[model samples]
Target: MDERKLPSPCVVVLVGPGAAGKSTWAGERFAGELVVSSDRLRALVGAGEDDLAASADAFDLLEAVVRQRIGRRLTTVIDTLGLDRERRLRWLALAREHGMPCVAVAFDTPAAECRRRNRERVKRIPADALAAQLTTWNRVKKELPGEGFDEVLQAATEVRVVPEAFVQADAAVRREDAAPRGLRFGLQVSSYTHKGGRKTTGEWIRQVGARAEAAGFDAIYVMDHFRQIPQVGRAWEDFLESWTTLAYLAACTERVRLGTLVTGITYRNVAHLGKIVATLDVLSGGRAVCGVGLGWFEAEHKAYGWEFPSTAERYALLEDALQVLPVLWGAGNKGFSGKVLEVPDTTCYPRPLQDNVPLLVGGSGPRTLRLAARYADAANVFGDVTRVREKAEYLKAQPRQIELTHLSTTLIGRDQREVDALVNQLRPRNQDPARYAATANAGTITDQVGRFRALAEAGAAEVMFSLPNLDDDLSPLDTAGEVISAFR
Candidate 1:
C-alpha cells in the first residue's frame, strides 16, 4: 500500500485472527514505508523468535518507532496481530492524544482458511495458539469501533485484499469520540457593583459565588472591567478588578470554578496576566479558567490611560498577547518578542495548578471565532440557538478541539405573573425588546429547558446564565437555581 494514498495524519492498525496474513500483506504492500512490526523488532533485539519477554520489548520498540515517524507526519502500518480491544484502543488513545486520525483493518477469514495458511508456512504457529488468537480476534472485531477506532476495514479472505483500496478501507476508522457528554452550566455575574449607596462589591460577590456553588453551577465568572458603565450608574462607581476578585473567590469557594467572563488583553502585560492566573489556579486548587477577549470600551481605556488602539490593532495585540501568555505560564523567566509587546527574560512565579489552564475566548465575530479555532480551548458566545449553531458550524471546520459556550440571560419564576414582572424589569435593558419579550414570554420551564437542550445538542459544550442583578436578596439566584434544577 502506497503511504501517499492513506490519510495524511493517521495511524492504521491491522487487526485479525492468527494466520490472517496481516504481516505478509503489510510487508509486500507497504514496501519502503515506515512499518512497525513486533516480529521484526524482536528478532533485531536478539529476543528469541518465540520468547514472550523479547516480544514485549520488541512491541515497545515498535511503538517508539511509530511515535517518532508519526510525529513527522509519516504514515505508519502496524503489522502485529491487534486481537485485543484494549490493545487496539491504546493505539486509538495515542492517535487522539497526538491529534492524529486512526483506522483499523480487520481480517475476518474463516478458521479453516487461517489454519491452512499457517500449515503452509515453514514457521507455523501451534494449533492451540491459533485457536486462542481467533477467539480474541472475534471479540475485538465486535468491540473496536466502540472503543474509538475511527475507521474499520473488513477483509474476510485474501481475495478481499485489494492493495489499492485496502489502505482506504482503514481510512474509515477516523471517528472522534462523541463531544463530551453531560449537562454543563456556567454563571456570569455581570450586575455586581459598588455604586449608589453600595460601597464594596465583595459582599455581593461572595453571596453570588456561594449561591452559584450551592446551585451546582459548574463555573462562576466575573466581568473584567475597571469601572462601572455610566448607563448603569455613576461613572466613578467603585468596581473590583476581575482577577483579584477571582483570587478571593478561589479561596472562598470549593466546588465551583472561578474565572472572568471576559478579560481584556490590553489591561495587563500578557506574561504577568498568565502568572496571575496561574497563581489563582494554584490557590483555587486547580479550579480556574482564563476567559479573555480583545479589549473594547474605549472610555474605560482612556480613563486608565491604557493603550487603546484601533479595532484591528487591538486584535493584533490580543493575538500576540495570547501567544505569549502560555509561554510565560509554562516557561520560567522566559521573554517573548512579538509585534505588540516584548519582554526580556521576565520570569513569572508559581505556574497554574492545572496541567493546561483552560483558555477561553469570548466573542461572536468571525475574527474572534478564527482566533478561538486557532488558539482557544473554548469560545464563548451570547445568542440564541440559531446563532450559536451557526458559529459552532463555523468553528467545527477548523482542525482543533475548541468547545463552544453560549451565554444568555435567564429568569426563572414559578408563576406567570412573577415571570412577567421580571421580564418587564429586564425589557428596558434589552437592545431588542421584542426579541427579549418573545423569548421570555414564549416558554414554559420545560420549553426553556428544551431551548437550552437544543443549544447543547447543536454543539454548545456549556451555557452560562447572566444574572439580572447581583442583589443580596438573591431573587435571581433562587430563580436560577430552580431553572438549573429543572434542567438537571
Candidate 2:
C-alpha cells in the first residue's frame, strides 16, 4: 500500500488453478486493458471459450500482448493458469529485460473451494483438467518464493511483509442509521510537493489550512519531520519545518486549532519544545495541541546531528517532557528533575494563553498508552477499528479520562468511479486495486461516512485523516467537510 513495497508497472502472472478466483480477483483490482486473459482470448477466437483448436492462437496472442506491454513498461496481469514454469520464466525474463519488476500472485483459495465453484460454473473444465491444475498449484505454491519474481503474494491476503506498513483488520462495512455526533476531525498534511514551483508552496500550504478550516476541521496538523518520511514520501522531497508552518497556518486560518501530528522528543531540547508550544498557543488564541512521541527515525537524527537515543532512553526523555511542559507554561518558575531531564529553572516568558494546553501523546505501545493515561489529556493511535477497539478498552479502563483519537489515511472519492480513478492513479502497479482500496480505506463519500462511524463506535472521539491527493491541492477538503458535517 505504501512506496516501500512492490506495487505497480510490473508484470504480474496469476499462478493458480481454475476456479481459484484469479480472474475475479484481477477484474476487481485491474482495468480491462491491464489484464490479458488467455481463456478470454480463446473464447474470442475459437468455437467457444472451451474450444481446443484455438488454444495455440489464444496463447500466441497472450504472449504477443505480454511482450508489447512489457516492452512499453506498462503493468500487465497475465490471466492464465500460470502453472507452466517455462512460460512463467519467459514472462519473467521479458519483464527483467525491460527493467520491470515481475510479481507472481498465487491464489491460496482451497482446492475444495475451487471444486465447489467449478461445479457451479456453466463452463466448467473437465474434472481431470481441474485435478491436474490443482496438483500443479500445490507444487507451484512451494516454488514461487524461490522463483525469479520480485514478490510472490497470496491473493487472499491484501498484505505482504513490509516494514512499518499497517494492515487494517477486516471490519464489516456497516453505516449507522443515525449520524455520529461530537466526533472531531482534523487534517494532517504529511507530503509536501514541489509541483507548483518553490515559491507557490507557501500559498498552497495556506490554502490547505484555510480549506481545512472551512471544511469544518477542528484542527490542522503537519508532520514534524526534517526530511520526507519514507512511509509517506521519498527523501529529497520538499519538507517544511513543522512549527514555522504551524505559525503560518495559524495566521492564515481562524478558529481551527494547530499543532504538529507529533514532534520527536529527541529532535530538540525538552525545554525548548515547551517554549515553542507555548508561543504557538498564544499566537493561535489557545488552539494548540502539543503531540509528543519517542523519536525513532535515526537517519534524520544523524543527518540533523541530534543524538538518537535508545528506545528506553527516548521514552525516558518523553516522560520528562510530558511532566515539565505544564510547569514551564505555568506562572512561577519551577525546578524539575526526572530520568533524563534536570531543568533547574522553568522560567518561560509569555505563558500559554490556555490555562492548560492539551497534550496528546502520539504512540500506541502499552508503555506509551500508560504514560498518556497517567499524564496526557489525549492519545492519538493508529490501526484499524479492531486495534482501536482493543486500545480503547485499555485506555478507558484507566482511573482518569484519556481522550481517544485516531490517525487514518483515508482516500475519499465522490463515487466508485472517482475512487477507481484515484486507485489507478495512486496504487502501486502490482498491488491489487481491491486490496489497495481496502488498505487505504478508499471509498465514496457514503463509504467514508460509514467508515468513520465505525471508528467512532470503536471509541475514537476524534479522527484525524489525510487525503491521498491533498499533497498538491485542497480539492478534497470541501468534500471531506461533508463527512465532518455529518458528525456535527
Candidate 3:
C-alpha cells in the first residue's frame, strides 16, 4: 500500500506474531513518512544496539517526535513490534487526545514462514521469546479496539481492515438512549454574612427558598464553610452551619431539592456526616443531595478550631468519607476503619428516603475524579462548556455514573437599557467588566434562548446561576423564570 495515500486522521499500527516480518514490511512500506524505531533510538543513546536498557528513553524520544510530526498533520509510521495492548494504547491515546482517527495493521504471516525468515537474520531472537510474543499478539489483537483503537487491520500480504465507525455509531445510539431527557436546573443561594450589621437570618433563607421554588428551579444549593469568605466581608458578620440551614430549607421548600454546593469532610467524622445526610434525605423525601469535598479554606479551620491536615491527608479523608458513607447508608452497617477515619458500628435512625440519595462532589482534580468514579452521582464544576466537557470525559472512565452541573453568573434584563443597568450593578463583583458585559448583554432574549439550548446540547445536565444578592433588586428567579418559560 502507498503510505502517502493512507487514511487521514488514522493511526495505522503494524503488528504480527514474533519474527513475522513486521519491521521489514514497515520499513519497506512507510519509508517516506517518519519511522519511529526502537533499535535506532538505543543505538543513538549509546546503549548496546537493540538493548532493552535504552528502551524507555527510546520510546520517550519516539513519542515526542511522532507527536510533533502528527501535530503538524504529518502521517507517521511506528516500526516497533506492536504486539501488546499497552504499547498500542500509547499511540491510541496520542491519536484520541489530538482528535485524530487510528488504524492498527497486524501482520498475520504463518509461524513457519516467520521462523524461516528469522533464520536469515544476523541477530536472531530466542524461540521462547518468539513464542511468548506470539501468545501476546493473539491476545491483544482481539482487545485492540476496546483499548481505544479506531480501526483494526489484519494482513497476510493482502490486508483486511475492520472499520470501527460502526462501534462509534453504536456508542452514539446508546448514549442517546441512556442520557437524561428531562429539563434539569439548579441554583446557588450562597449564605452571605451580611455586609456590615445585617445577618443571614432565617427569614432570608425562607425568602430565597420560596423564590427558587416559585421560579421553577429543580434544586437549591448553599455554599459550605465555617466563616464567610473574607473577600466578601468580615468573618464574624453572620455565618450559619450549611447543614443546619439545609435542614431549615428542607422544611420550607417542598418542591426544590435542598443541599450544599459542597460540604467539607474535614471537620466532621465520615460516619456521622453520612447519618446527617441520610436523616436529611429521609426528611426531605429523598430531595437532598450530599455534596462533599476536601476542605480548602485554611482560615475557616483556624477560626472554627478544626484541625486542618495536609492536602494529601485531606484527600485520604475525603476518600474515606466517600467509602464510609455508602456503608453507613446501606446494609453494611459495620463501621469503616481507614488510614484517616475509624467508625464503630452504630446505627442511625431514619435511613434515606431514596435507596441511594445522590452524592455530588465538587472540584477538578485527579483524586477528585477517582473519588467521583467510585462514589459521586454528580460533579459540580465552575467553568464554561468546554471545560465541563473535558471533566465529563475524565469522569466517564470511572465506575460510577456522574452527571455534570456547571455554575456560571447570569444577568437578565427586559431590554437593552435594563441589561446595561444590571451590568453596572454587577461590575464590583466581576474582575473583567468588558468580558462579563459581553456574556450578559450579548443579544436579545432570542439569543439567550439559543445559548441555553447550546449548553444543553453540549452535555450539561444542569446549569446553576449565581445571583448577586437578595437585596440587590436584580432577581435571578425572575431571570430563570423567563428563560425556562421561553425554552420549555
Candidate 4:
C-alpha cells in the first residue's frame, strides 16, 4: 500500500461486513478518542460488547456521540459493521449538514477471509447472521458511490488526512510572483499570563528573546495594549506595556530585533512615539523596528480613558503621522502641516541609531496600504494563502512598491493529534474546532512551513505571527526553527 492522506476535521465512515478488518484499520490510523465505536458503547451499557440485548441503548449513545463530534467539526471515524444503509445515510447527512467531507472507506476482504476471522473470534456472530452480512456488504459497496459521499476510498496499508490547506498550499508553492528575496520569520509574544506569574515575567521575557534569537527568528514582536484584548485573553489578564518591556528586553538579547506587532497610532502623540522607539533602537544597538497601525479595539480605548475617534478620523490622523514621522526621525528638525495634524517643532534628541529605521505599517485596508506604500518600508497583512496572494497583487499595483509581510495568531503542533489538543485549549465557547483553527491559524510545524512558504511565494518578505503558548512554554521555539530553516 502507498501513503495517502485525507483532509483533517472531516468525517470518515468505515464500510465492511463482519470481521472485514474495519476496526483494525481504523484503530491503526486514528487516535482512540476520535473513533466512535458502537461495540465500545455496548460494553459500557450492556453485559459486553457482543451482548445483543443492549444493541438499542448502545446505538442510541453512539448516535448522540457522533452528532456531538460532528457539531464540533472534529475528525470522527464511525466504527461499526457498515451494512445498514439507513445508518450510513444518517452519518452522511450529519457530515453534510456541518460542511465536512464524508469519506466512505470500503474494506474489501474475501468472504473466505471474513468467515475465517469471524470463527476465530471469542464471540462470533451466528453463522446465519455472518452470511446475511456478507450479502448486505455487496449491496452496500454498490450503493456507496451513489450515497453522496465526498469520496469513496479503499483502505489498505497507509492512509492519512491531507488537512484542509493542501490545494491552496500547492497553488501557493507554484505561484509565479512569489517573492524572490527570500523569507524571514518573526515571533510575536502576545500574552504573559503563564503559570509563572508577574514575578517571573522579567525572566520569561529574557528566555523568550533568547530562545527566539537562537532558533533563527529574525525578530521578536510584542502587542501594544492597556489590557489583554478579547481575542488573546480576557480583559483582566496580565498584560505588559509594549515599549517599556522591549526596552528592558533589549539588554537581555543580542542580534534579534525587538518591536511591537503594532503600536496604535492613537495611543500616543506621534512625536512621543518617535522618541520612545528611537531610545529603544539606541538601547538595543540599532536592533529596533517600529510597527504602527490605525488602532482598533475601541473597548480598550474606552477602558484606558483614551478617546476612540471615528474610523475616518483615525485614518486621517494616521496619514498625518506617516507624513511627519520621517521628519521627526531624520537629521534636520522639521515641522509638519497635514490633513489632520500639525507639529510646531519636531525637535527630538538621540535620533534612531539605524541609518534607516524599518517602518512597518500593519493593516490591509485600502487607505492603510496606501499610507504604507508611500511612507513605510513594509506592509503587514493576513489571510489564507489565496487571500494573501490577492493582497500581494493589490500591493504591487501601488506606484511605490514596499515589502509584503503577514501577521497571524498561530497555534502550532508537531502533528495532527497535537494540533487537535492545542485547538482544544483555546477553542472558543461553543465554536467548532475547524472554525477556531481558521481564526488562530492552527496547524503543525510542518503545516505552518507549507503555509508560510506559500506566503513567501506570494511576495511576502516576512511572516510575523503570535503564538498562543508563549505564556509558559519556550519549547515551541526549537520546533518552530524548522520553518526558519526552510526559508534560509
Candidate 5:
C-alpha cells in the first residue's frame, strides 16, 4: 500500500501497539514539526524508556506540550499507542475545538512481529504486555474512523531497525530543542548620574545610547520623571525629562528604539504628547514607541506642580488620552475635546516618519488592559513570573492581539560574591533590593539566562530591564547583549 500524505497544519496521532515503529514513522514524516512522544518524554524524565513509574508524568507533560503547540497553530504529531480509547477521545475533541483536522494511523503489524522487535530493543516490553497491547490495538483500530479521526491509515510492517538513522533522529531532536523562541529585550537607563558619581552630563547619556545600540538592545527606555523616585535615591537626585532624553538619545544612536518606560498621560496635554512622539519618531528615524499610562507618582506630580487627581479621575483622563493621541498622529487637522483636555482643529505638522507611532500602554489593571486592547499596540506588565503569567493570559483572552511586554529591574554581576556586594550596597536604599531577591531576575550571568527563559515561557513578548550599574561600566550591557543574542 502507498504511504499517505497527511494534511498540513493538522494533528497526526499515531495509533499502534508498542514496538510497532511509531517513533520511526513520526520522525520520518514530521521531523521539523513538534512531536509529542510518550516513550521519548519518559526517557527524558525517568531512568529510561522502560520506566513504567514515569508514565503518568510523561503523558501529563505530553498533553500540556501538545496543547501549547496546538494553541500556536503548529502542526504536531503524537507518537503513542492509542489503545486507551478515553485518552484518544480527549485529544480528538481538543483538535475539533481548535478547528484543526486530526488523522490517525494504526500500525497493524502482527503481535509476534511486535514482540520480536521489542526483544531486540534495550527497553524490552514483557511478552504478556505486548499481547495485551495488540489485543487493545485491534479493538481501537476498528473504532478509530467513527471515533472522530478525519482520516485513517493502516501500516502492515514494523519499522526497520537502523542505528545510524536513529542517531540522525537524535540530532534532529537536539536542533529542535535548540530553536529560539521569540522574545525581544530592551535596556532602561534608570539613573542619570555620571560615571564618577558627580553629575549628569550629555557625554554620559550619549555614551549610554551608543553602547546600548552597539550592544544590540531592541530599545532604550527612560523613567518619565523630572526627579528620581524615592526608591532609586533621594527625590532631589538627578533625573532628566523623558521626551528630552529620548530626543537626545535619538541623535546619539542609529539602530536601537527609544521611548519612556511609560509617559504619564497627565504631565502634558495629550495632543502635545502626540506631537512630541511624532517629532521623536522623525528624529530617531522611526524608532520611537510612545509608552503611556495613567500618572502613578503623586509625589512627583506634587514636586513638579502638576495637579494630582483622584485614582478614578486619572483613569478616566487616561482613557480620553488614548482616544485623542492616535487621531492627532493621523492625517489632517483634527479637533478633540474631552473633560480634561482639548485640541481645537489644529494640524499636527511634520508628521512622524513612521506611518503610526507605536503606542505601548503600561499598567496591569483590568481597565488599563481593556484600554490597551482598544487602542495601544502593546502593554507593559511588571512583577514576578506568576503575575506576569496571569496578566499575559488575561490580556491574551482580550479582543485584540496587543503585544505583552514585561518591565523589570535586573541586577547582575560576574559572580555570586559580586552579586552579594551589589545587593548589599542597594539594600539600605529601599526594601526593593531584598524584595527583588525573591522575584526579580538577579545574580550571575548563568542565573540571568535561566530567569529570562522562565519569562519567555510565561508569555512576555518583549522585556525592558534596568541595570543598576549601567552607568559605572558598559561591560554589563555588552554581557547582556551576548546573553540576549545567545538566548535568541
Candidate 6:
C-alpha cells in the first residue's frame, strides 16, 4: 500500500465490511494518535472486539473520542466498518457541526477476501453473518459519495493515500469559507486604563470579558500599549501587557475572540510575538486574531527605553514581522531570511488550533494599506463613516479583498438623556470626537442600530465598540446586546 496523507484538521472515516483491513490501512496512513478505532476502544472497555454485546458501549466511546478530536480541529481518522447508513449520517452531521470537512475512504475488497481474513481472526464470525455485512458494505460504498463528504476516495486493492491532497482540499475549503460573514460586532474594553467612577479591578475586567461574550460580540480587543493612550486617558495610567491581557481574557471568556486592537510590532520580538499569538489561539480554541501594526506611540517607546524609529523604518519592520509570523505559526524548522529579520532555523511547537489565525492590519496610510493588502486577512480603520468607506474602498481596489473593520468609541444608554450625559463626559476627555463623529456608534438601541446599518452599507464588515466605562452591573453590554440582536 502506498502511503498517503489526508488533510490536517479534518475528519477521515474509513468504511468497509468486517475483516476488510481498515485498521491496518489506517495505521499505515495515519498516526496512532490520529486514528480512533472502535475495536481498540472496545478492547479497552473490558469487552473483546468480537463481543457483540459490547457493540453499543464501544460505539458510544468512539463517538465521544471523535467529537473531542474534531472539536480541537485536529486531524482524526475513524477506523470502523461504517456499514450502517444511519450511523454514518450521525458522524457526517457531527463533522458539519464542527465545520470540519469529511473524507470517506471506502474499502472495496471482495467479500470473499474479507471472509477469508475473518476466518483467521481470534474470534471469527459465521459465514452467513459475514455475507450480510458484506451486502451492507456494497450498498454503503455507493452511497458514501453523496453522504455530505467533501471528498471520497475508494480503496480497492492497495490503499493509495496521498495526505497532501487532503491538505490542499482543506486549505481551499477554508479559503472559500473565510469570506466576511455580515457585520460583526467586536467590543474594545478600553476602560482598563482609567476609572470613570470605580477602580478597574481584576474582577471588573473578567466581568467585561464574560459580558462581551454573552452579548454576542464576535471579538474583544484591548489596546496594545505599555501606558494608557492619551486619547483614552492620561498617558500615565494603569495598563496591561497586550498578550498577557489577551491570555487572561482567553480564560475569562470562551466564545468571543481575544486580541489586541493592534499590537505594536516593536513591542516584542517577531518570533516571540508569533508564539504568543499561537499559544493564545490554542488556549482560546482558535479565537485569537493577530491584530498588528507599526509602532505608533513615541511616548511609550521612549518611556520603555525602546528606540522610536522613523515611520519608514517602522513600516519596514512591520513588513518583516509579517514575513516572520506565518513561518513561526505553521512552517516547521526552516531558515527565514528577511531583509530586517533573519533566522537560521525556526519552529513554533504546538501549532495553533486554528489552521490560519486571522491577521488584522490597522491604519489607513497608503504604505500601511499596501502592507495590509499584501499580508493581512483584515484591515481596521477608525474614523467617520465616509473615511471608513474610503479606506475600505482603497483596500478593495487592492489585489486582495481584506475584511474591513471599523473602530468606534461607543456610549450607548437606555435613553437619550443618559446617552447625552455619557457623551458629554467622554467629549471632555476625547480630543476629536466631533471631528471623527461617525466613529462614535452610540446612543439608544435605535440610534446605535441606525449607525451600524450605515457602517454596514459603507463596506465595513465589522465594528469594534469601545466602551468608556467598566461596571460590574454590565448595563453597557446589556444595551449593546439589544442592538446586536437587531442585526440577527
lDDT (Cα, tens digit) per residue for candidate 5, span 1-488 = 44343333568788999999888877764443367889888998898888999999999988998888777655678888878888788888888888877878888888878888998988688888888898888888788889868877666422211111121232323342487666788998888775555454787888888888887788999988888887677887777888998999999999988999888987887878888988899888999999999888998788778899998888888888887887887888869887776778647778888887888999998889888988888889997667889988987898778888988778776655676567666565654343444333456565566556666777888889988767657777887876576555
- Model 3 residue 172 CA deviation (Å) reads 20
Model 5 worst lDDT window (10 residues): 158-167
User: Model 5: runs farther than 4 Å from truth?
Assistant: 1-177, 197-200, 429-436
Off by over 4 Å in 2: 1-30, 33-175
Ranking by lDDT: 4, 2, 5, 6, 1, 3
Best by TM-score: 4
Write candidate 6's Cα lDDT for 1-488 as tens digits.
43233433568888988888888888775557778998888887746777777778889999899888777766678998888888778878888888777878888888778978988987897788889989888788788888888877776433322222122322323332454236799998775643443355676778888888888899999888888887777775667777888898889998988888899988888888888999999999899999999988998899889988888888888998877788888858987887678866678888999888899989888888899889989888877667878987888898877888888777677754565456556665643332222235435555566566667767889999787645556777878998787676
Model 1: runs farther than 4 Å from truth? 1-181, 193-200, 230-237, 429-444
Alpha carbon lDDT of each predicted model = 0.72, 0.83, 0.67, 0.84, 0.77, 0.76
After aligning candidate 4 to the native by TM-score, how far in Å is the CA of 225 from where it should be? 1.1
Clashing pairs in 2: 7-428, 7-429, 7-430, 8-428, 8-429, 8-430, 9-429
Q: For candidate 4, what is the TM-score?
A: 0.88
Candidate 4, residue 413: Cα displacement in angstroms equals: 2.8
Q: Which stretches of candidate 4 lie over 4 Å from their true place?
A: 1-5, 31-33, 41-47, 53-74, 86-90, 157-163, 166-181, 420-438
Residue 399 lDDT, candidate 5, scale 0-100? 78
| Residue pairs with clashing backbones, model 3 | 9-101, 10-101, 11-102, 11-103, 15-107
RMSD of each: 23.1, 10.0, 18.4, 3.4, 13.7, 23.4
| Model 4 local distance difference test score | 0.84
lDDT (C-alpha) at residue 409 in model 3: 55
lDDT of 2 by residue, 123-242 (tens): 888899999999988998898899878888778644221111211211212334443356889898888783786789988988888888889999998899999998887889888999
